[model samples]
Target: MKVVYLPGPKSPLEIREIQDPQPGADQILIAIHYAGLNHRDLWMKLGQYGGKKEDLVLGSDGSGIVKEVGSAVDKKWIGKKVFVHAAQDWGPDKNAQGKQFTILGNPRQGTFAEYLAIEAQYVYEIPAYLDLKNAAAIPLAGVTAFRALFTRARLKPGQKVLIRGVGAGTALFALQFAIAENCAVYVTSGQDHKIDQAIALGAKGGVNYKNENWSTTLQEMAGQFDVIVDSAAGSEFGKLIELCNPGGTIVNFGGTAGAITNITAQRIYWKQLNILGTTMGNNEDFQNMLGFLERKKLEPIIDKVFPMSHAEDAFKRMEKSEQFGKILLEIKS
Candidate 1:
């Protein structure tokens, strides 16, 4: 198998030949066809996120076909095309492979390889309606957005939601789901151009956070939003708190603009607001998200596609912070 692996933190990705993994009793081997590149993988590569030091393969989302199934696994799934779950639930055994939970590309080996072995149950059949290339883009970001809005916040149709960043993968989906539910959606982007992009994606309108006194402009639309979702919470964290209506919820999946920021206690207490944190969701959430995509035929915004051999270029493009959507690695079949 050919793999692009990080031998250590802050190290360059080394694409080379590696031994293929054998499936365990409840696991299966998959021939990876594509891998989705995310900023999270870069964070892990830089040791900013906690991942194992043992030659990590950096990717979270992937689409692949089953090559072989282990004993005790469903034979029906053999030869089926599937999307893989990035999360691993390996228990506390020092020698245990794949013991770490829900970690696909971080502390564990990821989908940058030509092949991978994972729990049979973690392999899900890609919706027949979806393109295989698109299925690779769905695992982490899709599941996270679905879990936060639907499970944690319970956003209802016709409600209002404000997103802190417009270009982020999850934020994009938040806007789409809001549109699907008939909710009024607003977003903020530091780059003035993303506001128009957000509008095209069905957001009612967006505010330009880069403009001087944009905070006051946003405040003008008072009591407008019932929910707020953000990955960029630098100085805007306080302003985002102010964007929400009373009893509104703020969903935080990540912080792209430095994690630590000041949020006034009065904002949380006086408004009776909620700040909910979400990570990659469970299997059920992934399944439900797939169902939604299958039914609605939703597509995650695609920023660019790089060949698997050009993984470094893909990472560089994502780090530029200018992409309009998900960056993908297009693997040769």
Candidate 2:
């Protein structure tokens, strides 16, 4: 099996031949067809996430065909096309994740290889509407967005919603899901073209966050939002608080921009606002996300695809935040 390995922080990614992984008693071995990049991988490379230095296969999202099933698994799964959920050990609780929950592509070897072995329970059949390339891009981002909007924010149809950082994968998924629910969706982006793209995708409108007093301008234009799905938590978080309607919810999943500063406690209490935090998701969220995609016939946005041999370039694109959607690495069968 050919695999990409990370030697350490500040070191270049190198390809090498490694032994193929075998399935455990409750696992399945998959021949990977495509792997998707996430910001988590970039953080690990920059030594921000403290991932293992040696023998690390950096990827969390992938779609492939089952090559073999473990003894305890049904043989019928063999040759079935599927996408692997990145979270593991989610346990039975739907309200929250278990203590042992872990995402793929860190301490454990991941899908950035020719083959990967994962628990059979974590794999979902790819919907007929999605091809392998697009299916590979859904697991991490889709699940996160689903949980943030439906589970945390409890967004309802016809409500006004705003998704911060419109160009990233999770944010785009949130926009799509909110729109499908018949919500009036708005978005914010540092780039004006991204805001335009979101509007083209059925968003009611959008604003450029780079502009001064953009939040105030948006509030006047669109009124207060019922829900706000945010990834970047910085000075803008205070603005987000002001933009939400009374009793509205704001869900935060990622903080790429840095720590939040100058939040007003009085506003939260006076408005009866809900501020929630969520990570990837529980297994229930993953199943619901898949069902939503199938029901809506939704397709994930793919900005570009790179051959597995050029995986380094994919990482570079993600690091520079140059992509507007999922960046995929295609594995040649």
Candidate 3:
């Protein structure tokens, strides 16, 4: 088995041959077909997420076929193609929920290689319509958008949504999702080109946020949004707040821009706004996300993919945020 491990903060991720992981009592072994790279992978590589200093595998989203089952898992699951929920260990403890380490990647060993073993409950059948390549891209970004919008923001059809960043893959999904539900979407993108790209995807209009008065433009368009999904968390957070309508919701999943923002008491109290934080989702959320992808025939946003041997190159591209969507690594025999 081949795997990637970040030896230390800002150090080069070393790919090495490691022993195949054995399935635990409630676990299953998956012959990984593909793994999706995300900004979180870059964060962990830079040791920005408070992950332990040792070696940490670098992925969360992956799809593959079942190779073996643990004692408690059903044998019927063996040989089935599936995508992992990726948040198997997102609970309070390492009980039936699996270990606390972010499974399939993160603090735990990941699926960057030949094989991975994880809790059976975290694995779900990939829709027959979707192949392994698309399934590999679903778990992290799809589930995050689903959970953040539906679960966190409780977004409803006909509402106005301002998707705060067109740069991240999640924003692409969020815009399309809101449009599907009849919500009017206003997209703010750093790049002017992405603004038109977003409109083509489903947004009613797009704003070039490079301008200092970008927030004002959004305010002038729809006045305010019932929901705002913000990928940027730096100084723009205050601007994101202004985009929110009274009694509206703003969901914060990742801070692509940067963290640390000034908060004003007036913004919080006057608007009666909801500030929600979310991460990788629950099994129910993952299932719903899968259904959404199936119903809409939505394709996973893949910017680029590299061979297993070029895994480091893949990481560097993601670290630089050079891609508009998920990056992938292909594993070949």
Lowest lDDT sum, 10 consecutive residues, model 3, at: 92-101
The lDDT, on a scale of 0 to 1, for candidate 1 is 0.79
The runs of at least 3 residues in candidate 1 whose Cα sits more than 4 Å from the true structure, single-residue gaps closed, are 90-100, 221-223
- Show the colliding residue pairs in model 1: 52-107, 87-102, 88-101, 88-102, 90-99
lDDT (Cα, 0-100) at 90 in candidate 2: 80
TM-score of each: 0.92, 0.98, 0.92
lDDT of 3 by residue, 158-210 (tens): 99998887856677777777888889988887788778877877778978888
**Among all candidates shown, the one with the greatest lDDT:** 2
Give each model's whole-structure lDDT.
0.79, 0.91, 0.80
Q: Residues 163-195, candidate 1, lDDT per residue (tens digit)?
A: 777886777887777788788888888787888
Deviating ranges (above 4 Å) for candidate 2? none
Per-residue lDDT, model 2, residue 184, is 97
Positional deviation of 228 in candidate 2, in angstroms?
0.3
lDDT of each residue in 1-333, candidate 2, tens digit only: 998888888678889899999899999999999999999988888888854766688889999999999999999999999999999988778777887778899899988999999999899899988989999999999999999999998989999999999998999999999999999999999999999989989999989998998998899889999999999998779999999999999999988889999999999999999999998998889999989998999999899999988888998998887888899999755
